[model samples]
Target: MKLPHDWFHADSEDKEMYGKELNLEMLSGHFLFSKNIEVYAHRNDATDDILCRHIDAEDLYTVVHLTWSMRPEIDNKHPTVEFHGSYDEFLQYNSKFFN
Candidate 1:
């Protein structure tokens, strides 16, 4: 398998680690970091319009679509660091960014 650009291959002397692929460069200015998360987002009934705008915008890599819910009862109210790269860099991270 193709490991991500920032990770090294496992070897006999290596200790196993749990992690996932993320566009690290995309997180260059952000403090948000996570792994093994299956994110789901739905458009607010205007998905088509938003998608069209993104398709036309030149910076497609950073364009992301988000739904309104994190769980069946909870909704994501504000934009976060992972979504915009630097959305939560200023928040006090408990060091989970490295784990």
Candidate 2:
């Protein structure tokens, strides 16, 4: 999926310093499929940790935290709850949190 051109502009500096592109192959190995929505786990500049991007049927996006490894337990501090709206919303929310 293609992201907006300005999507990472705000965090470009942090991205340049610490962000790693999402590993689609590795992410696929970690998540189980569900019918309603698709989840993507990718590396981001959140303390150099991972983030999850969720896409619904209409293509709207929601982002949340994901487990660092392929383990059953998730980090409760971060929670599995999704927030933000679109890719742009995800970036905005993260820009504040990360900064």
Candidate 3:
């Protein structure tokens, strides 16, 4: 098992705020700081997607497809998050994005 270090840690405040903005009722600010959320893997390519698991929610895994806004003048905040029920589902669904 990989232990979380500085690299594994995310911006808790931003994540919490994002969760609230998305109306993720289960993912509270406190929950963001807890050990329940684990970001296991990431695709550091063009997609820049992350694979994380919500340990508290029956180990529910999700792939967060981060869309960075290059033109902040036009789009202030980037939105849109997709969720999958299982790891297999997520992988199979996103096969095209990966090798």
TM-score of 1: 0.19
CA lDDT of 85 in candidate 2?
Answer: 62
Residue-level lDDT tens digits of model 2 in 1-99? 443332332244543332222232123323322323333333334432433444433445544444444343432333243454666666666566555
lDDT against the true structure, per candidate, is: 0.24, 0.40, 0.47
* Stretch of 10 with least lDDT, candidate 3: 70-79
| Ten-residue stretch with the least lDDT total in model 2 | 17-26
Give the Å shift of residue 72 in candidate 3: 12
By TM-score rank, best first, the candidates go 3, 2, 1
Off by more than 4 A, model 1: 1-53, 63-73, 78-99
Candidate closest to the true structure, highest lDDT: 3
Of 1 and 3, the candidate ranking higher by TM-score: 3
Clashes of each: 4, 0, 0
lDDT of 1 by residue, 1-99 (tens): 332222233342321211112221223333223322222221233431011112232332121333323322222322232233221321112123322
Candidate order (lDDT):
3, 2, 1
User: What is residue 57's positional error in candidate 1, in angstroms?
Assistant: 0.7
For each candidate in turn, the TM-score is 0.19, 0.39, 0.46
User: What is the per-residue lDDT of model 3 for residues 15-99, given as tens digits with 9 covering 90 to 100?
Assistant: 5543443333233332233345555555545654556677778746666654443322222223334554565666555664443
Residue pairs in steric clash, candidate 1? Answer: 41-67, 42-67, 81-87, 81-88
Q: What is the lDDT of residue 13 in candidate 2?
A: 50
The lDDT, on a scale of 0 to 1, for candidate 3 is 0.47
